[model samples]
Target: MVAASGADARKTIHPLFIRVTHWVNAFAIFVMVLSGWRIYNASPPFGFEFPAGFTLGGWLAGALAWHFAAMWLLALNGFAYLAYGLVSGHFRRSFLPISLRGALHDVLVACRGQLDHAPGRYNAAQRLLYIGVILAVIIAILSGLAIWKPVQLQALTALMGGYETARRVHFFAMAAIVAFLIVHIGLAVSVKGMLAPMFTGRAEAPR
Candidate 1:
């Protein structure tokens, strides 16, 4: 058995498929969230509505157009990601076990400013977060479908506890996804050189 050379040990790259899917997913989410907000404003299930200025697509019809288009993009990309993860063992290698104790320990270390990151390797906390956000996105997609075609998807709507309940579920799922993005982006920007590797795919461990 041979150990990796110093040069090889110092560098790694994100897979091309992972990088491409990640960026596409980011763009799709941005479009979906803003357009969905616009659609929500039309009915306002709750007492308040999103400000028109902050939402996409000026009007309800226009918003629906954007929302549906982005939804298809998300769905297709998600399928590809899942397929790759399963076939390539990426899911098992990257986020398997879902250890709560390990994640909590990582959080504690991070609080003490002791956590260190390695390229192409996720810590316990990160693994948990990635899995959680994936679930949240899946929830948002299902609930959105329930809301979109209640009559045609009567069983799904009923499974979600009726139309109104589904809307609330959808909104909260979107909120969870948004919250994850905030932390994810904050971490990328705060950690030196983290953001660059995500875009360029190549990563180098600083000495």
Candidate 2:
């Protein structure tokens, strides 16, 4: 009984590699977003520019450099995370068996201000949201590549419906990611002890 209790008391919510990759991906995404905004401000996408204060790099040339640098980091780290998740079965264990009905139920529960705080499993809503974010990141990367090297990556640009369409897709993908981040941060703050696991790799024992 004592041994069982000890095991239960020290649950591992995330492994070391996952934690490291997660933080690195976060930093890369942040740099890309800010620098991308700066680059976009140099040429408005839809006849409107993002505010200068909200952007990075301070100039078009500097912003382009920062964006490309961060893009490589984001690609490498993102793919590493994906490969690890697949090979380790982390994705299957954490996000598999998701269904529309289950997600709807979780959404209703969340609406009622009830959230499952189980340390060993993610709720359906989390699984769905996480998967959605992953797809969005893939879209952003593809579209970005199309825009970055339209002449060299002509086939990719055409696949994305040409350079202009790819740019639009990239912009919308970034917007979706930003929206997800806002919700993610809000949920983290609302849930007690939610943020600690990402840092310490262990969640508080389920109540």
lDDT for every model? 0.90, 0.90
TM-score of each: 0.92, 0.93
RMSD of 1: 3.3
For model 1, residues 1-207, the per-residue Cα lDDT tens digits are 124444465454677798889999999999999999999999888899999998999999999999998999999999899899889998998998889999999989988879988777899999999999999999999999999899999999999999999999999999999999998998889888788777777675554
**Which candidate comes out best when scored by TM-score?**
2
Candidate 1 similarity to native, TM-score: 0.92
Q: List model 2 lDDT by residue over 50-148, tens digit each.
A: 888988898999989999998889999999999999999999999998887998999899899886668758899889989999999999999999998
Segments of candidate 1 deviating more than 4 angstroms: 1-10
TM-score of 2: 0.93
**What CA root-mean-square deviation does each model show from the true structure?**
3.3, 2.3
For every model in order, what is the number of clashing pairs? 0, 0
Point out where model 2 deviates above 4 Å.
1-8
